[model samples]
Target: MPTSNEAVKLQHDAGAAPTAAEAVRAIDGIAPTTGTARQVADGVWWIRLPVAAGPGHVNVYALQDRDGIVLVDTGTNAPQTLQALTEALCILEPNHGTIRRVVVTHHHPDHIGLAGWFAERGAEIVATRGTLAVAHRMLHDKTLSRTPEEIDFAVLAGMKDLELAAFIRRPKRRYADGVAMLPNATSVIADGETLQIGKRCWTAIVGNGHAVDHLTLCSNDGLAITGDQILPGMSTNLNVPADQPDLDPISAWRDTCRRIGEHIDERSVCLPGHHTPFTGIAIRSRQMAASQEAVVSRLLEHLQRPRTAIDCLAAIYRRTLSLAERAFLFPEAVGYMNHLANRGEIVGLRRGKTMVWQKQRRPRGDTIRREASPAISRPYNFSSEVDESR
Candidate 1:
């Protein structure tokens, strides 16, 4: 018989995968309806809309201005998503002409896909320098592109090619940095700067990790447009792309989360880019911190078994992932693993063309105990078992 502590540990150690119902429940709860807007504070509204064949919807925020509305984050470039946003805006302001500016929290397609459409209608677009560059790269640079062949290589390198292709093809148009060339636009907003939109003022705080130069807009009305920085349901993916192989997203993301937590008050309502508005900034910040910490813990556990980064990724993701998903998974797993390796909790060594990780001998027994147990080895099968059973 196991002690209560041991039982709890076993339960935790079991690594029970989330059922499809649980996943759907988690996602469905965050996004109650497509294109529905929820008022979180005075003159502030959160909106969710479906994107192209993705896990969940993308969230955008609208701040009512005395003259017009300041929109933060446009949905994906799909016609339906655009139509949903248009309808929601019409409901909020009645007169769509009142939308003064469109500020993108980041350059991700889900956040900026419809920015050009809004810009065509006279909303100013803004983002960080790095974000703007990446957005341009995403749109214009097709030469150095990661084609299906590259995806297949990634698959052989340990990823699912089909999913990777789906992820890559989602973005429609990418915008260049700075204010878009819209006739009725104002200017590009940058870090440590403030902009007055509608009846409120917002400050742009730029940080990196999830995306290069991700911006979180904080308003005096106790509202923060967190974009994908802090999601309510799932952890945000942090990766080091083969194109930008030198990027260290884990450190950047950790620092960004800490900064956001420090600046915003605990009671502030977060208008994320993918979920309903929620309160308790401090609590969410702690949760975000813990989530990343959990990833590090998972990485360390895999290291004890002397697995390569590819092996660790399979262990962490635990299913046949789409090529796109595998692309997202591998770099994220390696990044967190590298972060822990840098902290001396684990060690990574290059064996031929692969990087294998292992635990470092630490002084404290508690430190060893703090590291999570190894993952249960399993084959990759991305299909939802719960969905099949149902």
Candidate 2:
């Protein structure tokens, strides 16, 4: 059985392949308790912060600068996170002074949540332009309503009638709830830009498919502060964009994995946004890309009959999804559907207010051979289980 954190990551990827045993080796066997700091490298400390829900903890790094510290990826804006961060900072203050700068890896609520709080304390918030724009919008926007595009996308995912009405009426989760505040001014960093954080000069590598322009810092000494783009033990989620419903993020994600793999070697120690520090980054990145390919391949086979994205869940998932899992995994299913459609392997047919997908018929001379998947029997007629009408 996987641990809670590993289970959460599996759910995030909608049941992607398990982490390869030899791909990554954890540097630290166990993580430090909340409010405590663990030194991972010279002038670099790992601080785990408590998360109210999901994964349970997020890892932030403190780099010792000449005058103070440069913190990367602040935890959520919750009280427990703030308390833990305060204690961790106090623990590092004797050697690192105070936090002079904060480098946001992404605009996710968990990573950038406390950025505003730090900015208020005179810490320079540095992030990519895409990240800053999205973070600012999510932090400040309070109004939540399903746009016409969103509703249409939901319908295409097989939601309609009472179910669609209920979904529309459901209170949208607010990103502001996790974030403290947004700073009026932010220092924007670009991809491939060399940053002088502390003593080591690091290059910023921007990746997509997880978040818009997610930043990962790589030092010449082979230490990488990889955010969610390249997690060690499990695959990250590639959610379909809400605004661009037809956009395919899986392709971007695969390209990113390849690029990161080429950039970082096996000897590099990677400090991810979650999970313990690990090595064999090249292998892990390849594993992630291959795992996603397997998912897409499996999804292709499951498209033998006309199905909705919601109905297709029965085909890909290893087990039944919980309520919370369903809410998050819905977008992932849509992502897979879009990927297939974009590849010309499937076509969506409008069925009333809903859209169903069927495998695209290819020419006899232009057939695409599919890899053989393990034989597993699952009942296709899972109307009771999917319950799209609910």
Stretches off by above 4 angstroms in model 2 are: 1-19, 322-324, 350-353, 363-390
Candidate 1 to truth, TM: 0.74
lDDT of 1: 0.60
Tens digit per residue, CA lDDT, model 2, 269-324:
99998888999886676666556656666677888888898777656565676544
lDDT by residue (tens digit), candidate 1, 1-390: 001122222222233233312222221243435556666667777787776633446778777777778888887777788788877876877753477777787777778777777778766677677766766666665454456554543443343346545655655222332223322333566777888876667888887777877899887777778887776545566665555443456566666766676567856777777655667655554455554555456666666777756667645654555444444457666666655554557766655544566888666533332222121111112123211321
Per-candidate total of colliding backbone pairs: 12, 0
Residue 13, candidate 2: alpha-carbon lDDT: 55
lDDT of each: 0.60, 0.75
Instruction: Give the best candidate by lDDT.
Output: 2
Error of 2 at 237 (Å): 1.4
Question: Which residue window of length 10 is worst by lDDT in model 1?
Answer: 373-382
